[model samples]
Every structure is written in structure tokens, then in C-alpha cells.
Target chain A: MKLMIYAAALFAGMSLSIEGAIYGELGKSIGKLESSFYNFFVGTIILAVVLLFFGKGSLSHTFKAPKWQLTGGLLGIFYLTILIVSIPLVGVGLSMISVIVGQMIMSIVIEHKGWLGSSPSKIQKEKAAAVVLMAASLFLIF
Target chain B: MSILILAAAVIGGVLLSAQSSINGAFSKQAGTYESTFLTFASGALVLFVGILFFGQGDISAILDAPKWQLSAVWFGVGYLFLTVLAVPKIGVIATNISTVIGQLSMGILIDHYGWFGGLQIPFDWQRGVAIVLMLAALRLIYIADRKSALQKKQAA
Candidate 1:
């Protein structure tokens, strides 16, 4: 069961890589901001249609939800914009590694704190080692 | 890289983790597609205003793009949808690391194959070692999480 969840996450990551490449081309053809706009714009339409047929929850609950939780969209935009800006300044390799390290560190903190409604998982030596190894691997790959 | 640039890049990753966590929690309440739709809808609304003010590229260029290229949005959709489903179950660290491993693995394959007109960089020993190391890391994390989870269950 855990392995299945891991595989799903892995597949999600693979999809992201492909999307990144495609959007990279789109960004080159259009402006970066424009391409992003296009993505969200088109995505909104697509999801709207899907929700019409398949959605099962109340979107209105979204408004009643905590204000901070609604920042997903803003965070998404910030992430892409930051990468677009920082990758040019720092080399892609460094940027990529830094991002991975940051992700691991932040994730550890989030899990440990039970933030964002995630169950608390105390940090262990093995988990720390795993993060270190993963960071090292990214450094090598990029 | 300067410290500032490194910080910015890292913050980008931080935002990514936060986005996943938030979206995952939101999906539990609003349903996955509904949560995703709200995100894109809100994001599009903001970007529309951004484009109105600062967009420089010809937005019409998207219309001329190959049909396959447009399908990238679906890949993006799949990524977020899966992430929303995974994070609450696996926790943020596991989901994020797994995704990172997958992303890099796929990226290496794409580079090696020179897919999408990219430069053909042959697979080297370094990349192979890196992948092996990543797999090891994943295994270690899994065992660690499993051990802790089991302990918690026993304590309960």
C-alpha cells in the first residue's frame, strides 16, 4: 500500500517533468508570464468541464476554508516565477539542487509539525540520511 | 551561485511543497477536481490581470502551437491530482521525494534521448549512480516512516 502511494507520487513527478518541457517550449514561443497565463486559463476551462461531470464536493466550502489554505494558486505562480528568475542568475544545476534541498527540508518540517493537516512524523536518523542522500543524488544528476 | 539566488531557488521549492500540502488538504474537502478547478480558476483570474499589466508575449502564439503541445495542461493536471491524493496518505516528505526522484529520472531519459529537440546527452555513470542513490534514499525513508507509524499504532 505504501509502495503504491510512492509509485503514484513518482508518476506524478514524471508528469511534471513532461509538463515542464512542454511549457518550456510554450514559454519560448509566448512570453513566460503569458504562457503561464495560458496554462491556468486553459486548465481552468478543462477542470470546469470535468467538474461538471465528475466533481462531488462543494466548491463553496472553499470560501469558508481557512484563508491561508487558499494560497495554493499564489504559491504555484510564485514557484514558477521564482524558478524562471533564479535559474538564469544561478546555473540550472545549482538552482535544481537548491530547490530539491529546500523541498526536503521544508517537507521534513511540515511532517514533523503536522502542518497542513499532515500527520506528525518525528524526524529519525534514517529520514535525515535519506534526505542527505537524495540531495547528494540531485547534485550529481544536475 | 550567490547566497541570494540560492535562497530564491530554495524558496521556490518551499512554495512547491506548500502548494502540494494545501491542495491536498483542500481536495479532501472540495473533492479533487473541484479543488483543482478552484486553483486554476483563481490562478487564471490573477494571471489575466498580470497579463493585462505586464504580459509581453503574444498570447495568440498559443493558438498556433501544435495540438500535442496543448496537452501539456493535462499532464499538469495529472501531476497535481495525484499529488493531492498522495500527500495526505504518505505525508509531505515522502510524496515530495518520490516525485523528485521520478522527475529527475524522467528528465534524464528525455535528455539522453534528445526528446523534444533537446540536446542529446548520453547517459553516463554519474547519472546511473545518482539514480541508484535516489532509490536507496527512497527505501530508507519508507522504512523509517513505516517503523515510526507502526510504533505510533502500538502506542495507541
Candidate 2:
């Protein structure tokens, strides 16, 4: 279980790095909407392929996504499009710093309240301090 | 120019993080691919709506998008899947941090090497310090988890 979690973490990181590169490149060329739309359109194709091969009967399960899941999709579009747009404008360093700061702030509320079905955990002082320090470091570097 | 760029990055980061959390919420209820597809599909829907309501509805923009730009959608799909898979196992905080660290580490390399373009940011002392701090934060989070786990084991 732990190994799977670690593997997931590694993959998550790698995915983010790829995303940063894509944003950096795409931001220079296409407008936000076009870039994002095309990206998702392509993603749909890839997902379709997976469904046809390894997915088997799993494709049907995806259509049943709840109404709230739409919110997640909307957020994905906004976040990704913005990230792509920002990379060219701001540069990756500053963009990353700002995003991390926002994330740290929001994460506290999300985790504490269990807003997203996350296992509840208190926003202890140590964690809070760590977030603050991390933010500060990001600012200094950027 | 630098200020504007930084602002964009900040906005992008916040929006992405929030969206990821929303995706996380959906992932908890639905299966991973379902959540992934819903997020992308909904995002597409929102974009289309925005084009009609606010944008000029420029078909040219969509048509003109480079082939490579379109290819990035697959990466987005993969990213969503990874997030869904990791968030539940590592918890939100850890998963987010790990990804950020991964991004920064790779981003710095990409920038320094000018892999995509001739633009490169030299790795100065400040960047090194930032990397160390990030690693330390991860360590602290890990230690906290271990402490909690040991306590539970002792109690059991």
C-alpha cells in the first residue's frame, strides 16, 4: 500500500513537471481557450483509446459521473488554462510560487473541515508553520 | 513584464490547486477515470460557454492551435488520473507537496537547460535554498505521519 502511494506520488510529480513544460510552450503559441480546449479534446481521444483497449467495460462507469463532478471538470479547465496562459506571461518560477501559496492556504481549510471527503485532520501549528515557511521560501526564490 | 508574468503564474497556481481539490472530492465518490473524464468534459463545456458568452467565438483560434498543443491533452488526462490515485493514499497535503516538489525540480532543470527554448535561469544560491526548504517540509510531513502511525501501533 505504501509503495503504491509512493509510486503515485512520483507519478504525480512527473505529471506536474510535464504540465509545466506544456504550459510554458503552449502559452507562447495559442490563446488560453484554444490551447485548453484542444488539450482536453486530445485527452478525450486518449481516454477513448484506453477505454477501447485496457478499459473494456469501464467506459460505461465514467458516464455516470455525478453532477458535482462537473465542478471538478470546470475547475480543471480553469486551472490548466490559466496555468498555461500564465507561464508565458509570468515565467514558471513566479507562477509556481503563487500557486503554491494559494494551495497551502486553501489546503488548511479543506483538510480541517473535510470539505472534499478527505479524512479530517486538525490544522496543527506545526503544519501551519511549515506551510508558511515553504511559501516564504518560494517567494524568496522567485 | 516580470510582475505580470508572476501574477499570471500565481493565478494559474491557485486555480489549478482549487480545481485539483474539486477533482479530489469527485474522485473519492466516483472511480478515477470517471472523475478524470468529468473534469475534462466539464472544463470543455465551460470553455465553450465562455466563448459564446464572452469570447468572440473565434473558430480560428481553435483551428489554428498547433498539433503539439493538442497533444498536451493526453498529459492532462494522465495528470488527473495520478492525482486521483495519489490524493487518497498520501492525503491531500502530502500529494500536493510532492507534486509541487517534483514540478519545481524538473522545472528548474527545464529552465536551466533551455530544453524548450534558449531561455534559461541560472541556478543560483537562492534556488538551491528553496529546494532544500521544500525537501525539509516534505521530511517534516513524513516524520509527523510516522509519529502518528507509531502511536497508533503502540495503542493497538
Candidate 3:
């Protein structure tokens, strides 16, 4: 079961790479923001159709759900907008590396403190090595 | 529940990549924000309808729920938009490698800390070794990229 999970993660990782390459082309032909807009618009349509027949989740509860849950759409816009802008200025690899490193730094704190609904897990010693290694790899890439 | 979360997260990651590529191709014709807008609009439409039919939860509770949970949705779209932009500029492999590295690094931390109600998977030496391996992989990719760039320069 664990192995299967790993394989699944691997597959997910592979798709991300392909996505980046294709999006790059799209960004060039149209525009960055426009490309992102196209994705969300079309996605909404397809999902609508699927939900019509198969919907199960209480999406209606969106109102009843925590307000924090509602911010996904807004956050989505922010992330995509920035990505569109950044990829052009920096190469994909470097941009991705920066994102990863940034996430690690923030998540370390988030996890340790149990902020944002995360269960508090104390930071382990190995984390230092992980960060250092990540930094070293980023340096090499740079 | 833990296993389910694991599966969902993994599958979600893969689909996100596919979405980025598809969006990239579509954006070529549609325009950037236009494409992005369509994605969100359509998605919102679907969710709305689904909630009407399949949703058991009260729509009105959104006002009552904690404000912070709303922040959850932003990360995904951000990832998608970035992937679309990066693919064409850097090519797929380079972009993929960087994202993978970033994602895995985060994933490890999340597992270690059990963030967002995820199961806690404490970091151990085995995980440390995995990190080392990841770095090595990064080094290899970097070298390959440099070599190709150098060859292109020589040919030019």
C-alpha cells in the first residue's frame, strides 16, 4: 500500500512537469493571465456537468462551512497570477526551486506551531540537514 | 481516513499537472486571464449546482465558519497558474523538477508536523536519505541542463 502511494506521488510529480512545458507555450501565444483565466472558466463548465449527475458533497454548506474555506478561489487567483508573472522572468527550474525553499521555510514554522489547523509536531533535528541540503541544491542550480 | 487523505493528495497533485498543461495549450488560443477566468467560473458553476443537488451541508453556514478556512483554496489555483506560465518559458522537465522538489520538500514537512489535520509521519533517517537522493537528482538534472545549453551555444 505504501509503495502504491509512492508510485501515485511519482505520477503526480511527472504530470506537473508536463503541465509546466505546455503552459509555457500557452503563455507565449496568448498571455499569462488570459491562459489562467481560460483554465478556470472551462474547468467550471466541466465540473458543472459532472456535479449535475454525481454531486454528493454538501457544497450548499459553503455558506455554512467555515469562512476560511471560502478563500480558495481568491487564493487560486493570487497564486496563478504570480506564477504567470514569475516564470517569464526566471527559468522554470530556478523559479520552482525558490517556491520549494520558501514553502519549506514557512511550513516548518507552521507545523511546529500547529498554526492553520495543523497538529503541532515539534521540529526534529534532521530538519536542519534537510534545509541545508535544499539550500545547497538551490545554490548549485543558481 | 489517513490513507484516504494520502490518496487524494497524491491524485490531486498529478491532476494539477495535467490541468496546467491543458490550460497552457488552451491559453494559446483563449488568452491568459480569459482562460483562468473560465476555469474558475466554470468550476464555481459546477460547485454551485452540485451543492444544490448533492450537498447536504447548509449553504448558510459559510458565514459562521472560521474565516481562515477560506484561505485553503488559494494554493491550488496559484500552483496551476504558475505551472502554465513556467512550462513554456523553461520547458517541461526543468519546471517539473523544480515543482517536484518544492512539493516533496513541503510534503515532508507537512507529514512531519501533520499539518491541516493530516496524519503525523515523523521524520526519520530514512526520510533524510530520501532528501539526499532528491538533491542528487537535482544535481544530475542541473548538469544535464547546463550541458545542453552549452551545446546549443556552441552550435549557435
Best by DockQ: 1
Where is model 2 more than 4 Å wrong at Cα?
A: A1-11, A52-67, B1-8, B52-69, B80-98, B145-156
**TM-scores of all candidate predictions against the true structure:** 0.82, 0.78, 0.49
Candidate 3, position B83, lDDT: 63
User: What is the docking quality class of candidate 2?
Assistant: acceptable
Give a tens-digit lDDT track for model 3, residues B1-156. Answer: 433322232233333333444444444454555445445774455445545565544544434534333232334444545665565666655665666765556655554665544335576766676567557655654554456556657978
Which of the CAPRI classes, incorrect, acceptable, medium or high, describes model 1? medium
lDDT of 1 by residue, B1-156 (tens): 467777787888888888879988987887778877888888888888998999988898888988777887888889877987898898866886788778777767766775654345678888788778877877887788778778978999
For residues A1-142, write the lDDT of model 2, one tens digit per residue: 7777766776667666566667567656655566666666666666656655654233354456555545766766766766776666545555666666666667667767877556566776666776767776777776
**Considering every candidate listed, which one attains the maximal lDDT?**
1
- Residue-wise lDDT of candidate 1 within A1-142, one digit each (tens)? 9899999999998887677666656676777888788778889988988888988898998879898778888888777666555533443334555666677678788989999999887788887998888677766755
Name the 10 consecutive residues with the lowest summed lDDT in model 3 chain B.
B2-11
RMSD for each of the candidates: 3.7, 4.1, 18.9
List per-prediction Cα lDDT, in the order shown. Answer: 0.77, 0.64, 0.49
Instruction: Write down the C-alpha DockQ for each prediction.
Output: 0.58, 0.46, 0.04
